[model samples]
Target: MVVEGAGPSCGLIDGFGRHVTYLRLSVTDRCDLRCVYCMSEDMSFRSRRDILTLEELTRLARLFIARGIDKLRITGGEPLVRPGILDLFAALSEPIADGSLRELTLTTNGTQLARFAEDLARAGVRRINVSLDTLDPERFRALTRGGSLARVMDGIAAARAAGLTVKLNVVALKDGTEHEIHDLIAFAHAREMALSLIETMPLGDVGVDRVDQYLPLDSLRRQIAGRWTLHDVPMRSGGPARYARVAETGGLIEFITPHTHNFCADCNRVRVTASGTLHTCLGQDDATDLKAHLRTSATDDVIVRLIDQALGRKPKGHDFILRRGASPQLARHMSETGG
Candidate 1:
């Protein structure tokens, strides 16, 4: 499927016969919360000088769009905490409004969403994924180390009011989560938001052993099936998640099973960190530093060549179980990689 002379096909085809179409662009590594499972409270933050500018991100995104990327998910260490970020959203929307891009979305902690949900919708973002682990305020505070669950609730409501389709992501853990899972599904149903259960992966040195929290997808799905029938929902995007519909509440559920690599067969995304590094795989240490290559002097063809090389080497499956070490292989925190 390659062009007559170019290294790869014009459709952004990878060597594995998968077309990469989704880009998860990180705006900043700085976060507003210190979640125990995501980041350590004493974690050192990167200086603003090392982060990518909004202009650089937008430029790189346009090149990706031309390379067959149709969806962009602006992620971060709570991207809303990044100053002047609404401007980036407005900038990315130009492609969407003009039909060059199919979708533009974001993932946030929802702590600051109450401030910009409507503004973001007006800026051309129609979907958002808010990270919510628990429903109880006390437990939420304990997990996030002082984050206000009330603020997240208000933010979800505000996004809905602004006509944005909202999805809630819950980090599933092995122990003491039976009741919380039920409550989370109920909460999503009440708000008409889809909920996705993400298995806690061994991503960073979050100061806790992941084996203690690594909840299996089967166990969680079995728990949900005990209450409501889950009918499968097929989405066009060949992303990592597989969705299901909850018949009783008319809600949707997505399972992010990196642990089992259930969705790896059709994985179709690459992530760009805030520091302008291209990560072809989320759980792998492989990365291509694109900051220098993406300078003003670099042509679009040059950028595409670099991207083709990266996508060609994209790992087919995440190394979740085959790891030979006790510590996390990926030293960067999830915040630094945009979750």
Candidate 2:
């Protein structure tokens, strides 16, 4: 079932002409944690039939990799919650190891990583991104409803012990968990891992509908009164992001200011949801039903055309933070967006 024309044949000349290399794949829309920032208490999950089978996922990955997607990221409501996740990793990473793909990574809530991190690393997951909003136990319990801070902490240790390139993702909210910024930085520095403080995007079901608490990351950066210099890590040669290391005598930190600094200029990625839709941008809700297409026209040429069209439709970049009217694609819940 190796589709022919899908062999790295389709790409476009963007305004700057960068070939898209990264692809984020959502394996399941079901997550175990009902984080206050994502879904509500009674939010329903996507039907089981909607999720791509492991074979279907591997086939999709193969087709995309054949189309010049060099880097792959596995995301979900909580990627690990999906059954056969490690097997999925094995399935996806084997192609990369065999030279059909270049990189493979996973994003998880860290609650489930403690038991599986070592196995994931062994299965060829080179990098890991763990989501942790607050360090305070009670506050964490509040932020991610029913999540235990201790469990997440153990997961982090397990991930580090497994030799994965770990990165901590923190969503900075104004009055809620902004107080944990310094603590997060200290933790990352102590463990020699990258800590990225993300600006809260207004994209969630009930959690973000109450998005009034979104923090301006620039203000967060400026509030660090202590003199610390940042050294730019060039991403222009590039894969996923434009990152910098914050340096000050004894320690350093990595900050990903995606909102303040629009990496979209050099953005070389697209996302496919768990149900098999191709999304050009998380902020712009333009997506094509790749799953339906796969069921009908599994031909490589047809798939390539759809991917090229989707890439061409990618918005210039998202300016929702600056604009007031409202954005159509910007309001979907993060759970649905797989990030």
- Give the alpha carbon lDDT tens digit for every residue of 155-257 in model 2: 9999988899888888777786557777777777778877777776656446344346567677877665354566666545343244566665244444455
Error of 1 at 12 (Å): 1.3
Tens digit of per-residue lDDT, candidate 1, span 52-146: 88888888887788777888999988899888998898888888998879999999999887899999999899999999998889988988999
TM-score of each: 0.94, 0.90
List candidate 1 segments past 4 Å from native: 1-9, 234-236, 296-298, 322-325
Look at candidate 1 and tell me the lDDT of residue 180.
Answer: 86
Q: What is the alpha-carbon lDDT for the whole of candidate 2? A: 0.75
- All candidates' lDDT scores? 0.84, 0.75
The lowest-lDDT stretch of 10 consecutive residues in candidate 2 is 320-329
When summed lDDT is taken over every stretch of 10 residues in candidate 1, the lowest stretch is: 1-10
